[model samples]
Target: MRWRIPLCLLPAALLLGAADEPQLVPDVSQREVEIQYSFTGADLLLFGAIVYPDGRKPDKPADIVVVLKGPEQSIVMREKQKVAGIWVNADTARFRSAPSFYAMASSRPIDKIVDERTAAIYELGVDKLQLSPSSLNDSAELSRFQEGLVDLRNRNGLFVERPGTVEITDGVLYRARLPLSARVIVGDYTAETFLVQNGRVVAAAVRDITVRKSGFEQFMASAAENWPFAYGLVAMALAVGMGWAAGAIARRI
Candidate 1:
């Protein structure tokens, strides 16, 4: 949501010895939306996708994991010359799954949001819908990646990965199945992109997320209902790749 840092002014007497003393402060940054979707009921799925306008392409057929980030907007400060500083403020309150604080009157309908519209509450689906970078790779060895992810999910009070996570290979799409508990909360849930090393989490990309059942779900329902096949292929391919990687990794061990 809106994160503010208070500034403490130095007493005039304290600065008497310093003729030209200057102080710097953390300025506000821009905000961005991570994901947008439609869902219903406490039992819902998150729909997300990343837009990569420009980047590198690898042919190694690497595994794909999504990590959403804070809202599209974040606070940014600019230092113009030596004596002047600029501050910019933004938020991700509009996105359904922003990392900012979320409040919908506490008792309002899930679709309705009454929190800071110009602020971030919690990060939305960490990067699934936000186009964040991949947090894991094969050569970067570590441990307890999956377990850590499970723990993170548990601590966040979530039952599974944000709905609608997709993987793209050679321009083909795939879907992912995330685990979730029945008692998961109905709010933002942070997620990560884990690098699995020997069946554990080694490296990870962290993302703040939000979860709710609202109009966004309804929007996706129409789209998903029309082209479930496209979604199916993406999900299947991701599964096969993960499975193959796991098996191959075991052989090496």
Candidate 2:
């Protein structure tokens, strides 16, 4: 389902009015996402506006936190146990940076929009991700391996947290709806936007998305990543010429 809008518009920090400095005019409903092969998932919307800063629109009520991140791997997470009875894999935790897809939306519920040290400093939920771990365990074994790596990346949907899925209107538009399944995971993705008020973070924005893998699944993923030994010798000579043409059509049927 090809769709790629987003034709340049991110050089607007000219601060048209520049009052309290709040102006995140983001946008993204697909800006280069082509993962073919019956790829059945995608729904990003992340609209924006929030100009404010004296240019009107603001009588309180202002808090929109949307974050859609992906790309930044380095994980290990293991903790099984049971051992002799079956389980196994004792304790392990590598996580030096995780976020191969993480979504968070809010217009409320982020602790009433800010606090808890500004949502653990920008991590804004997913249990305040910012996963560390590279050694020094303890603290209940690093909170049981960071709650088993956020419960195995939230049951393999690559972690997601939607609190009040943002949706401002009168206060100067704003939207959200970032969903992208089918085990999404290609590369480069970021769409942060926070503006909160009283609790801080007056403004902030960032965008950039790419996803990838297009037609014919991107030509066999670029021939197994740029000709891996001629794509394993042409996939073993086409699996031995389709097993000798299916044994001569099963001996002429």
Best model per TM-score: 2
Tens-digit lDDT track for model 2 on 67-89? 98888888888778795689888
Q: TM-score for every candidate vs. truth?
A: 0.22, 0.35
Off by over 4 Å in 1: 1-56, 66-167, 171-174, 177-182, 194-207, 211-253
Worst 10 residues of 2 by lDDT: 9-18
Best by lDDT: 2
Measured with C-alpha atoms, the lDDT of residue 105 in candidate 2 is: 85
Question: The CA-based lDDT of model 2 is what?
Answer: 0.83
